[model samples]
Target chain A: MEKLCRYETDRVGYVMVLPYIIFFLIFVGYPLFFSFILVFHKWNIISPMKFAGLYNFNFLLHDPLFWKSLRNTLIFLIIHIPLQIIVALVIANILNQKIIARGFFRASFFLPVVISGVVITILWQQFYSFETGLFNTILSRIGMTKIPWLINTKFAMPSIAIMATWKNVGLYIVLFLAGLQAIPSSIYEAADVDGATARQKFFYITIPMLNPTMIMVLILSTLGGFSLFIEPYVMTGGGPINSTLSCVLYIYKQAFYFNHMGYAATLAFTVAFIIMIVVIIQRKLFETEVYA
Target chain B: MKRIIFYILLLIATLIFVYPFIWMTTASLRPEREISYLSPLSRNFSFGSYITVFKRIPIVRAFLNSLIVSSSITISVLIFSSMIGYALSRLKFKGRELIFMVILFTMMIPFQITLIPLYVLMVKLGWTDTYQALIVPGMISAFGILLFRQYFKAFPKSIIDAARVDGCSDFGILYRIIWPNSIPALVTVGIITFMNTWNNVLWPLVVIRKTSFMTMPQMVVLFTVGGQAEAQVGVQLASAMMLAIPIVIIYMIFQRHFIASMAHTGIKG
Candidate 1:
């Protein structure tokens, strides 16, 4: 009986984690494995899936819409990556000091992070309205004529990038703030004592110390850029001529809207593969100080 | 002089950040006829737009569905993730490392990659249009587990050791010792999970086919493009504001925690 009790404790230690393991298999592991199988099959629910064998991938390589989605997604990353990091770091630096209303300022920044994306999209749609929008209101006040924020193909992706940045900047601000606080005051004091200019101190002390945080921010923001859907979907309808159609959004359009499940699944796998490759290359280059 | 300039810039930045939301609330207040012609900020606010938004669609029901899904996901995540986190952190069990590696691998894979296959799985199970579609899949979150594990690993192990020596059971150590001491981390996970599930669009769009099962974001998507005619912009804004305001209220209460949780998850996920 004593031996049995001891063995039960020994075995139960691993047993306690059974729930998470089961859930991981169901939700994550199964789906990941199935996506591989799905990429080759041309089945749209109810029809028997034929083994198309590399044809789906071939189509993806040649499809203009796929290429366009990729281009738009890259365009999104271009606008969002640098903008998200810079704004977040600036806000984090400003708030990290002995500022008054620190909590209030922090909340004001983080407020959008909690609001639903669809809501933000809907909200920004009105904000982008050509005539009565607050954007045009500000522009007209600045003596510039009204601009088509979402309707103009050129402006639409940038506008989505703007909204995406706002939605996520709060989280990055906190990250930078954490990184900033982890820097001891002694380093800054030593820099100040050396008569180093504030610019030099910021560039030399702050930037170098925050490298890991910056890497984390870069990986995260890039991931976010790839997954974007709601902003462009709601604000641009992926249009005013497909100007803002993101890769994930395009995949959704093909899979759900048009029932091109095989093509959509293939496109989805390519994106996931691309994200992995991008992160791998990024890690290599980041370690080598090669900025992409 | 520098301080003044900084303050002024901060003020202006805050205004720019907040202007659209303020405009949304004000726009939702204006009379229906006056929506597009008048300035969104200049008009006297009215509750008529709110009435119209509520009346035109299933806004109230959608809000409740979102509340249910977000809360369920958050609560379930907190319970399950914390359980696994405590084990992964404190238990000297075999396969703990393997479990963490699994969590990490799953965390890096984006949702869209798994989404199509998961839909097929749901169809096979005949679980379409049920709350199970929204709640079951994401209740085991990698980000939550990582956050809790990181936090709990830092928790002094002496307490658990003492409890074990005192003949407390394993779950006893978890329930009485770990959970009571884990309020901050739990709240952090709770805030983030609630917000993510609340804001989720793509999954809810795929799973919940019936208009009656629609969550708030899905409803906003419906109002935006789930139509033939031009949706009344004012009513759409009103519905969006309604979805945003409550979650934003919870976020405002736990704002610092929200940022901290999300920041940590960003690094670890």
Candidate 2:
């Protein structure tokens, strides 16, 4: 009876996993393999695919617009990741304290994250409006000149990054709060006994202890920053001379707008490749810097 | 003294974070010409913008489409992921390790790389502009499977052994014995999946061109960005409010669960 049950269990295992395997193959496996094949061929959706060796890749190498979008993405990341870390960490540290209405504060901060990005983007687009936006209206009321937030190329990407930070910082705050909780109260007690000042404890003990969480925040923010499409799409349409055009937006335009499937595939592959390299380098640098 | 300072600073942060939303709520009620005034104290307020939005688009249908797509995908993900999770965690099967590794591999490949081919496949299958375009591709997630597998591993195997010895079928054991007891995993996966699908704009934008099939976010974005609500800032904000309010209600009701599950998952839509 045990032997018979063992065989049935094994068969059941196959049955259970089979659905996912089929879904995986149809949705994930085939798409992935097709994407690989697409990189080496030239085809619009309406046309039969013609093999083109490395032409798409060669074109991508020299595509100035593609390079510009990549530069824009890097700029957004540079501004976003640091701002996100500082804001999230500071708020998290503050919330980690024994305070009044901590729940209310946390919920308020996290509200934007749960809402649709499209909605937030639309709201901020209006807020960043050049003429009558709230920021500029306040500026004008204070006897100052109104600065264009999203209209100018120079201010556009940075402005989006700030909005992105606002939307996402709450998540990181929760993460950092969790990390803050994990640090033993005993360490702080030890520091107190040693006559350590608050600033000294924060810099010397808290910062070092929070290294793992900091690395995680860094990675998650990087991945999040790379997926910057909706904000720029809704707000700028990658305009103001393509200043805020993101990597994904560029690929979307290529694939859908121009119907350059093969070339877009090449760009997609290249961006994905770049993201992997950047993430791997980040891990190595942060791990060695902190651990060493 | 320090606590007072912290409180003041937090109050400032709260205003900065929550003030825009407050402004949006008030502005959506203000007349279109008075939108720039930016004060809740303004005398003029009406339901004109909300009515305009309803006149402009089929919002009720779009809401239902979003509801149907999100809930169906969430339920499907919960069932399929747990089943695979059970198999991977408890049962011994050939290629189990390989399957686990394959799912991990899929998780690493960003959705952008495969997007074009996936679109082409959708086109070839004649699924574009259909509900299948939105629902089918997202029915199973690599992350969901891995999350379930990790959760199921911690579940005690002695109970599984006992159930098996008691002549419970594998499906019976999973559905009756394991799943009922695994509420945390189920809720985490379900909420995240539903929220992601609800807020998703890109895939729906890519696949569904028909107005009848547009999801709520997609419909709102297109309506606002496509210039239908041009010069009608109040109407645009009204449409946005309609999109945001449902998610906000859900988040408020399940505030603790939403935060805990999102933080735990570390996966954002």
Top lDDT model: 2
Q: What lDDT score is found at residue B228 in candidate 2?
A: 88
Tell me the fnat of candidate 2. 0.74
Reference-based lDDT, each prediction? 0.81, 0.89
lDDT of 1 by residue, B1-269 (tens): 99989888998888767766776677777765566543555546777667776777887899899988988998999888888887787776667789889888887787778989899889888989999998999787778888888888888878877887788887888878888888888988887778778878889888888989999888878777766214777777777778788877886677667777777666321
Off by over 4 Å in 2: A2-9, A288-292
Q: Which 10 consecutive positions of candidate 2 chain B have the poorest summed lDDT?
A: B33-42
Which pairs clash in model 2?
none
Cα shift from native, residue A260, model 1 (Å): 1.7
Candidates in order, TM-scores: namely 0.94, 0.97
DockQ of 1: 0.60
**Residue lDDT tens for model 2, B194-226:** 999999999999999999999999999999889
